[model samples]
Target: MADLVFTVFTSLDSYIEKPGGVFAPPPWSDEVGEAWSNAALARAQHLIYGRVNFEFNKGFWSAAETDPNSIAAGIDYAPKMNALPKTVMSRTLTGDPGWNGRIAGPDIAAEVARLKRDVTGGDIFAFSGAGAAETLFGADLVDEFWLMITPQLFGDGKPLFREGRPESTMRLVECRPLDVGSVILRYRRASEG
Candidate 1:
């Protein structure tokens, strides 16, 4: 069985959104790209996302794969990301996602559990935020959380953790600060401690 890992990028204030409607920080850097790529490659067997995030990433990274002038790490990362098997959880998206991906049904939790059982290697990683993150968290299916805390903060933005979900506990696995001001905090379900 595979573990389900939810990896998210957040601002210092715990917001997952930027000044614009983007999720990742603007003016991407090689350092950030390298960190993200390394982390993703370390244990990800399947990449999962919500429909909206799936489309956005498909457009951006697909273009990055062909952009000769793109950052070195980003250029390298794009192909790896694009080639990875993906599952987009959406009810409305029809047919193919134009990438190596398929649309998952409405039952996010059950689908995630099925993926966990089906995988033969590595972990099932969801680079998630907002609705997708909330669904997985509320379902109590996330085995681990890997959060990257950027140095900046947004006064008002989409929060990583929302209200209404029952309170849960986590066991700290690791805390590492990157060369940049960004920090990575890793945790697992408290029951696994």
Candidate 2:
């Protein structure tokens, strides 16, 4: 079965977004993190996202591909991101979600489980959406977590690990520091370890 890897980019305090719903790259974000992300994306057979993140990413990356002046236009992973098949978990979004994507059914957990059982060769990567991640976490469907933790703190914001998730031990698979002072941590469910 394909492993479901939830990848998150957060502040040291674990907040994924700043207050007021601002979504910006961490101050310490650099090429090292980008390279690491590219490698992970390269290994993903399918990309998954929550509705908000999916829409934001599609708008940015799709525009980048066509806009030569776009900051992300030259990024190595831009094309791969656009080309990869994506499943957006959403109940309100209808029709095509663009950029080689589809809207998932109402049952999010079941759809994710089906992907884990059917997809082969590479793993499924969840790039964003804490709510979706929490749902997957609660259902015991997430196999791994790849977190990029920056040094700064948001004080208060949208946390990646929210309340009500089932308590489970995580095995530290890898830890590496980037030149920009950000740290990359990989963890697997201890039960699987």
Candidate 3:
């Protein structure tokens, strides 16, 4: 079975985005970018937002397949995110055959759980900010969280946690600081009460 992982780029002040829905492009230094690039590829199975994030990532990653110096080339996530079984949670999207995606209307929980049972190995990862992250978290379906904390602080903006966390908790399993002030933190969901 595959593990459910949610990863995001968050500022030190606990904001995923600045006011007006603006986001900092991830720092892609040779070392840091390479690390993040490989980290994403390891997830293997990608569960993503249907429209905005999908279009954005699809453009960059699909291009990385050819661009040598691009971070996409180093990680090899393009083909992985494209080829691996994926479920895009969206009511507004009509999954195009070109992207090899399916339109999942309602029954979001049922669909996610089904995908979990379907995958033999690897992992299912949710990308982007509060909206999609909150949905999966509220459903209590996420098994692990890989948060990349950037050094900058947005003061007040987008946040990761909202209401309806199921009264559960997580135990910090790992923490590593990169060359830059940004850090990588990993947590595993604690057993449910």
Candidate 4:
């Protein structure tokens, strides 16, 4: 079974992007990127995302494929993710003809649960989809969360997490600091209603 994890780069103000909903500059360092990529490749078998992030990354990473080493390992892994299977949690998107996966419905907990038992032993990652994140959180399907927090802040910015009735309680499992003043925090989902 593959675990369901998430990769999000948030600002100190708890925003994942700027006022325009565009993600902030690439704040990942080689070490940070490598660690994330290694962790990604180690446990995640699929890339799940929102339409916005999916499109933005589709263009950003496609242009950097030639020089894999020139980009962060996460970006370097783009091609792999491009070629890998993905599942987007979108309602407005109508087309993804060349995409590696499909858009799923709201009731994804069943599908996610089934994916968890596929015997691949990788992770099913939610790649910056606040809506999907919220949905999964509401469903109590996520096992762990991997949050990459940067030092900067945007007083008015896109939300870093899906807002809902917060889980009864989430337990912190670990925290790692990066050289670029960013920190990665991991949390395990505790008992929920």
Specify the highest-lDDT model's number. 2
User: lDDT of each prediction vs. the true structure?
Assistant: 0.80, 0.84, 0.71, 0.72
Kindly state the number of residue pairs that clash in model 3: 0
Model 3 stretches with alpha carbons more than 4 Å out: 64-77, 95-97
Report the C-alpha displacement of residue 143, candidate 1, in angstroms: 0.8
Badly placed stretches (over 4 Å) of model 1 are 19-31, 64-74
lDDT of 3 by residue, 1-193 (tens): 7777788878888888888888676565666765665776665565656456766767766666667787767664456765655566665766472455666558768877777788665777777567777778778878888888888878887786777778767888778788887788888877622
Compared with the true structure, model 4 gives a TM-score of 0.82
Per-prediction TM-score to the true structure, in the order listed: 0.88, 0.92, 0.85, 0.82
- The TM-score, computed over Cα atoms with residue i paired to residue i, of candidate 1 is 0.88
User: What lDDT is obtained when candidate 4 is compared to the true structure?
Assistant: 0.72
Report the lDDT tens digits of candidate 1 across residue range 43-81.
888999888889878877777657766553346556677
Per the 3 Å backbone cut-off, how many clashing residue pairs does candidate 4 have? 3
Clashing pairs in 4: 43-122, 43-123, 44-123
Q: Identify the superior model by TM-score, candidate 1 or candidate 2.
A: 2
User: Which tens-of-lDDT digit does each residue in 63-159 have in candidate 4?
Assistant: 5555555453345466676666777777787666346767776678877887788738567888855666677777877777888888997888768
* lDDT of model 2 at position 44: 96
